[model samples]
Target: MPVATFSLVALDCPDPEALAGFYAGLLGGEVQKYNDIWCDLRTPDGIRIGFQRAPGLRPPSWPRADDNAQQLHLDLTVSDMEAAQERALALGARPLDLDDDGGERNFRVYADPAGHPFCLCRT
Candidate 1:
């Protein structure tokens, strides 16, 4: 039998370096060049976040009245929701849902620079 463990989460981006930098800052990670077409971040937890170049990549549309279905998204945990949201917005993230009254302090959804959905959850 063979055992497997999660190693990395890779996302397709038009510019690997730009996306890599965004994630690195968000996760407190360090970015490194994997190759000409790829870049990766060595996160504090040892998990890698990889970015692969896709010249014609189109970002997923989410949380809109006529939004295209999202393929996938990442959830991030933070202490202060407002502050985190502000920081993310400053970093090129846009708010997706304006009204989220979930019972529990789950998360707030936003889109990255390229319009890919991601979340900021209460930690």
Candidate 2:
């Protein structure tokens, strides 16, 4: 048996509530505010993602490995890539590489309002 249990994945962002809200909107979760410095989203899948406030936080330079690397990113699987992309965009997710082989690719990249890079993958 494992000695340690898996807890939650915490993300560093400028605004915890905003980031938590963004994730909640995309992932079908309930947002719980622990405080101004911390917030969490508990998804239907039982995954808990935590967002912490970092006043001077800077977003990663995604798809670029030099200077500022992409520390981490989330890959969200969707039933319809096109519709998901539309929804994400409407939710303040800025498109990074949309014309990536014109749907030939398995995933499309984007940056959240907080500037963290995430991918929308076809399920």
Candidate 3:
């Protein structure tokens, strides 16, 4: 028998509940109770997003602090860059000082609540 194929991405956060909530809202998914120390999000495509509570989670400093590197970044495609930026900012995404040179007419970058870098690109 072949091993079942699955894609599981784990994110370390200070609060699993809060992080799960953020992703649930952003991805339009359902948050399923997993256990005391972790939470799982069931995506529409069956992908599992796992969040583990790390009391001392130190977020990466992207576009700055050359040493600390971002583990992973989610690229989101949207219709409007400005609108998407506003929404993401409202959802706890912080702006980083990256040189877009105002050249990214179709994309912008931001950091998540946990300071993970992600981009919103024009579809």
Best by TM-score: 2
Off by over 4 Å in 1: 64-68, 102-105
Ranked by lDDT, the better of candidates 1 and 2 is 2
Which candidate should be chosen as best, given lDDT against the real structure?
A: 2
Score each candidate by Cα lDDT.
0.82, 0.90, 0.76
After superposition on all CA atoms, what RMSD does each candidate show versus the true structure?
Answer: 2.5, 1.1, 2.8
Order of candidate numbers by lDDT, starting with the best: 2, 1, 3
Model 1: per-residue Cα lDDT over 19-71, one tens digit each: 88887778877999978799999889887988889888878877543455687
Question: Model 2 Cα displacement at 114 (Å)?
Answer: 0.8
Clashes of each: 0, 0, 0
lDDT (tens digit, per residue) of candidate 3 on 15-69: 8888888777666688976776799998786878899988887787765556667
Better of 1 and 3 by lDDT: 1
lDDT of 2 by residue, 1-123 (tens): 899988998999999999898988899889999889999899999999999998998788978797778989999999898888888998899988886587778899999988999999987
